[model samples]
Target chain A: AQSVAQPEDQVNVAEGNPLTVKCTYSVSGNPYLFWYVQYPNRGLQFLLKYITGDNLVKGSYGFEAEFNKSQTSFHLKKPSALVSDSALYFCAVRALGGSSNTGKLIFGQGTTLQVKP
Target chain B: EAGVTQSPTHLIKTRGQQATLRCSPISGHTSVYWYQQALGLGLQFLLWYDEGEERNRGNFPPRFSGRQFPNYSSELNVNALELEDSALYLCASRMTGSHNEQFFGPGTRLTVL
Candidate 1:
């Protein structure tokens, strides 16, 4: 079965410092990875996705993720952390072929990013 | 273009009651997906519909069901609701493509007493 794991329950980062929210995935075939952020009482907002191409994929709000094939990891990153960037981050994976064609995503237990000023 | 939209931003029901949630997909989107965001379960895929057909579903019970309309709008019906069913129900839509990303709506908060 396809699955996503976000090792951290919460990541604390100081303002102006870089932040990294870790994510790892398991899938039978090639994986389409995605990142989404949710704020208090709001729905999830798409951050970025790794379908194909460059290992590093940039997304909304100055955030980017590196898709490492060998490591089976797609880590969300930001060079400078801001208080507004704090939110719940989720990693999801969809298998490329076979019965997984339904496009249903397997999501990880979310990680909360807390950026302190 | 308008994004995915869901109605009844909040719904409250008692156990054993039935609850209905509605969603409107983005224009031109042919696929609709429903997910449940519970307290600790993360996000679980509930159903997937494409071209007015039920393409697939997750490991949820039969009480959780839904259908898509000809215009691509959809409705989720939960029968025999339980306290565990209290959650944020999210609706998402995507164009008919393997690589396209899904857009989400402001989910409905369902509370079961």
Candidate 2:
């Protein structure tokens, strides 16, 4: 079984300030984690992923996520937030070496990021 | 490169009717995935197709089904739709050897009246 959790329904931060959105996962095997951003009425856009190695992975739009094995977390972060960064963020996971090799993702409920200028 | 594309950006169907949503994967990508994003429900995996075969399905009932054509494009058919079926139906595609980074399309907004 694989699952992802975005603990916060929303996160607010001011422009030029650092921002973080929390995500945690539970999977039977090594986890394949991903982050996506969705604008209003737009499809999800891939941000970054953590498959293996490099606990810290940088992604599009100056966003990054750190994979914590012991803590079971993959939190998205940005050094400086911009108003345009405001959007719905999603965390997803898939267990590697699972019975099914299909690329099926189990998504988190999603976190709405609000970057106020 | 053309990303995944879904047809009929918005669909309206009455209860007990059937809805068919289509998707065309990116060039060279062979895997297609379907998901439902209902209001407040987030994204629920619906189906997965690779190499023109149904690879896996979610916990949806038999009424929710789909197929992949030889070209790797796919279609999702929802039979006997209910009001609760109203949601954004998303289609994504990924390369076979990729690390499950599925690129998504704009999606088809399915509204069951």
Candidate 3:
């Protein structure tokens, strides 16, 4: 089984400050980790993914995530937080091996990030 | 190229009724995925269709079903709708062997009365 855990329901950061949203996962095999952002009333937008190689993956909107295999974590990060970045973030995982070639993702409960000006 | 697209941006249905949501994959894409985003539940995988075949489904009941067309479009049909079924239904598409990075549509807001 594959699962993702976003320990924080909400994270607050000041504008211009760095922000991090924590995510951890449990999977049977090598994990394909992803980060997605959802604005109000909109669908999820892909942010970044860690398929293989490179522990640090940069994505759209000045966002990035670091994949830690030992920690089983893929945490979203931003060098400088902006008010526009305030939205819901989700961490998702998919197993790379086994009979699971369906490409179905298991998403976390989501973390709401609030960047205050 | 155009991103994934979904139809009927908003839908309303009463309990016991059925709701049909549609999706069109991106050009050259061969897979479609459906997800349900309900309050408190976040996003739950609903179905995965690749090459006009149902490759995988989540733990949803039989009432939640869908099919993919020859052109790689897809439709999600939810039978016996309940109030709890009211949520945003999101559709995503991906190219085969594309590292499983899916592009999502704006999604349909389904409100079950």
Candidate 4:
């Protein structure tokens, strides 16, 4: 079985400061990890993903994540925070096994990050 | 190209009633996925369809059912709905080969009273 965990329910940061939102996963085979952001009344938007190589993957909106196999973590990072970046973030995972996807995305509870100016 | 689109931006149904939500995948995309996001809760996987077939499903009950049409459009049907069924239903779509980059719709707000 595959699972994801976002240990923190919320995170706070000041605008212009660096920020990080942690995520961890557990899956049988190689994991396909993803990060998504959701704004009030808006749909969940894809931020980035970690399918294979390149431990550090850059994504939309100056966001990036580092995949650590030994730590079993894929944490989202931003060089500098912005008030607009404040939103609910979710971590997800799917395993690749056979012809089709091995399983559905097991999502984390999500973290509400508040970035103040 | 247009992204995923869902019908009935908002819906309200009493307990035990049925609710049906529709979704249209991006042009040329052949896979659709359904997820339920309850207020204060994260995305809960519901079902997945590819090439007009049910490729996989989550741990949700049988009441949470759906179907995919030949054109890659889909419908999610919730039977015997209860008050706890209130949540936002998201529909996402992607090309068969590139399932990871799924595009999502604005979502349908389903309220079971």
lDDT of 1 by residue, B8-98 (tens): 9999999999999999999999999999999988999999999999999999999999999999999999999999999999999999888
The candidates' DockQ values read: 0.88, 0.89, 0.89, 0.65
Preferred candidate (DockQ higher): 1 or 4: 1
lDDT of 4 by residue, B1-113 (tens): 78899999999999999999999999998889999999776788899999999988977899999999999899999999998899999998877664357778999999988
Question: Residue B8 lDDT in model 4?
Answer: 91
TM-score result, candidate 2: 0.98
**Reference contacts reproduced by model 3:** 0.90
Q: Model 3, B1-113: lDDT tens per residue?
A: 88888989999999999999999999999999999999988899999999999999998999999999999999999999999999999999998894769999999999999
lDDT of 2 by residue, A33-105 (tens): 9999999998999999999999999999999999999999999999999999999999999777758455689
Estimate every model's Cα lDDT from 0 to 1: 0.95, 0.94, 0.93, 0.90
Candidates 2 and 4 compared: the better one by lDDT is 2
Q: Comparing candidate 1 with candidate 4, which one achieves the higher lDDT?
A: 1
Interface RMSD of each: 0.7, 0.8, 0.8, 1.8
TM-scores of the candidates are: 0.99, 0.98, 0.98, 0.95
Q: Model 3, stretches more than 4 Å misplaced?
A: none
Which candidate ranks first by DockQ, i.e. highest? 2
lDDT of 2 by residue, B58-105 (tens): 989999999999999999999999999999999999998857599999
Ranking by DockQ: 2, 3, 1, 4
Candidate number of the best TM-score: 1
